[model samples]
Target: MLIGEVARHSGVSTRMLRHYDSLGLVRPTGRTVGGYRQYTTEDIRRIFHVESLRSLGLSLRQVGRALQDPAFTPSALVGDLIRQTEERLRREQELLDRLRAVEHSAPTGWQDVLRIVELLHGLNSSSAARRQQTVLTSAEEMPVSTDMLAAAVLSESDPNVAGALRWALARAGGDGIARVAAGLSSANGDIRQRAVLALAEISGDEANAVLAEALENPDAAVRRHAALAVGGRGDTAAVPVLVGMVVEGANDVDAAEVLGSLAVDATLATPIMHALAGELTAHPADPAVRIRLAQALAEMPGTIALAELRRLATDPDPAVSLIAAALAGVLEERAED
Candidate 1:
């Protein structure tokens, strides 16, 4: 193609192309016998890319240097582009901050949007991990006012999801613990279960106390979850209470889970062993609960436990049997040393 064709495709004027050629920035592939500059497909591509870079804010000098640099790897280019993106995000954040002062979006605004955008700009694996840390720290420091948690949980967006989780963690031991725990206890099965699982992260006596109080909720769902959370916490003080629930339990599913999660002592060991042993036999029909029981046994593997497992090795569910056998061997080996 000629200079005019190259100019049309690259959005550079013919005079600019001539100037670039004079500077040795880009030269025509050949010259026709008629003395017209003839450009190649490759030359056009280079011009297009250079013009794109210029549009993206790089100086023409920088584009020329980049074209000359043979040492630039694909990885290096990607890293440099990422750095540029982060810089842009920072500038955007500054603009957003100014906008916030001018027109407040207290409950909802461009400020939060910009914050999330900045967080995501250069989001590599390492950055994502750092974000997880920040989310935790920010949650701990910020008061979990209603709007914050409401935004985080309700919005399925990343910043919102992360923000909500962090806020939840921060607000964990607050008075809302009672209400949230109540939600866990009284909501539909899935919501209740999810709430209790999230509540697992909660710490301190205040959290456990809230859970304990939930046991007295008029709703049976609340009572069941309170039992599980207490048992799972393995606070030996709650052992008597948990054991009562175990004895009178209607939901063996929950019972097995709570028991399996418990960090039992030798005192509770005998009872745990009895319940687990019975589960390995009587509930052969309930594979799920049986697996949980086996897991608990594995956590406290011993000679008697190994003997029980050795028998199960040839049983119907090879997975359960094999895992039990493996735990027994590992425990025996660990003890031998």
Candidate 2:
């Protein structure tokens, strides 16, 4: 049966069905070919269990857990959960009793009535806030946020955005990285790219296999996202991937950015030196790529970096000439050291 039929047969509103879905309560037995939920008789019975529990003042959360292990019949879980339920009921009863007390007394003035109304509204708002918080806290325990990556990616291209994203990744508390991993091959290009970047930033908790596999992604953007995310970790595990990105230049622009990020670590000199040598020796097929390559080389200091700079000095582009000279000065300082 469809959701509407389930709602009618189960005497639970479609709204409650959606809420149940959100809470991992009763899922549809299957979906129709067109994607409408098709519920089984078993599904309807589960829906009633949820409704009966709710009627008993048990939270939907309580009902969801009960459905998880129906046969276990643990007195302890029931006792603890029922006690917590009683606490909520007692709080509600206290408010009702206060309201009754207020109603039993006559309001002496318009000001008194207004004050009473304000008190009632405040109580309702507080109660609603508590309910929402409970839902959020319980949902958070599941460790999967539908928008965890988007939350990390939005709002700014720099500073505020980057700071917020870094904080989110560094502080992420979930076994739910699978959500992003699942989105890696989404039909939408942007979603795929965003997940790639997220997985990259979250590289430490992530499996090494995921990172290694991402290096082979067909999309250059995704590949770079992986490279930058790993490089951001400053983990030596990422060194090999970064080295691979250096040689895999689908274009020189992205590879240069990767090296620039690598240069943020002084210990990365060895890998950056190797990449610079490869680019200088192979000679980039694009003039712009050649320029970015020279820029990355100019940013590093060493015999390899110096030799690459000296080679670029003879390039026809004047920009390359200027950068080579700057790299020479860096090499001269190395001699003086």
Candidate 3:
């Protein structure tokens, strides 16, 4: 076959075939009387081989080595190609994700598109400062999509960046609550924790509802955080968990404070007093537990807490009695105020 016929048959363009011949990648096997290049069956087969290698991302030089060198091993080259392809795929997937985020933002024009893209890039940046700046700067410019904030918060590992992202999410409004809530169900423990923390900062009924669910989570840390958040909102349901935290001495001080706040409601005051009294009764032998409970009891307002503190004041353990007596005196003075 002549060059044109070979090009037609192989789908390789004539110019490329000539270029291949010039590079000695594929030379014509013969020439006609007019001295035009001619290709034999062997030459056409080589062209197909070159095209085959090129399809696998082989450069022309590599293709020449692959076709001509009997010593060339494809295993290394094939492995390299696989790595390169995987890298390309990762880049492409990231691009697709950015595009989806931009689409989710419902950008009104090129400016919105660019802003969203920049924010997405910054969120994925290696620098925690850049990520934090992205969220703060973009927030000042326009409303960030909740999905973007949700994703950033879930993946954020740096303490400062995570805090800023939470603040940004809170400022971005409740739009991302569902997305953050979805993270609560993630199999990753860190992700679930992040979800609960983010939810704690979000001010909405939906966020509160999700935090309510988290209060029963099997993860003790998750449950504790959820309880604290719910208790802050004055939900009585958190009383038991807050009470438990006092007994276990885990953030017991803060838990007691929240319980005290809950006790401000007249209706909650009695139950709050009862719950602490019950803990004291259940763990009478545990003086350390009693000491924490004694402090917690003092956080409550009204005469019930004062009476409980007085009863604890005469306890047999000197340390427990000492702390209880001190708290009772403080409450007695406060009652006068």
Writing each residue's lDDT as its tens digit, candidate 3 over 230-292 gives 999989999999999999999999999999999998989988888899999999799999999
lDDT of 2 by residue, 127-169 (tens): 5453233323323442212243233343123344344443454
Clash total of candidate 1: 0
Better of 1 and 2 by lDDT: 2
Superposed by TM-score, candidate 2 places the C-alpha of residue 65 at a distance from the truth, in angstroms, of 50
The runs of at least 3 residues in candidate 3 whose Cα sits more than 4 Å from the true structure, single-residue gaps closed, are 1-92
Candidate 1 global lDDT: 0.59
- The Cα local distance difference test for each model comes to 0.59, 0.60, 0.91
Better model by TM-score, 1 or 2? 2
**Candidate 2 structure, TM-score to reference:** 0.45
Q: What's the best-to-worst order under TM-score?
A: 3, 2, 1
Candidate 1 residue-wise lDDT, 1-337, digit = tens: 8988877876799999998898778898878899877998888888887887777666667778778888744466557767998999999976674444333324366666565444333221245456454455445543333333322232223553444463565454453345445445444664554455445456668778777665665555556666777777785444444433444444545665555455345666676666567756766766555555555566553454666666666667878777777867876887788
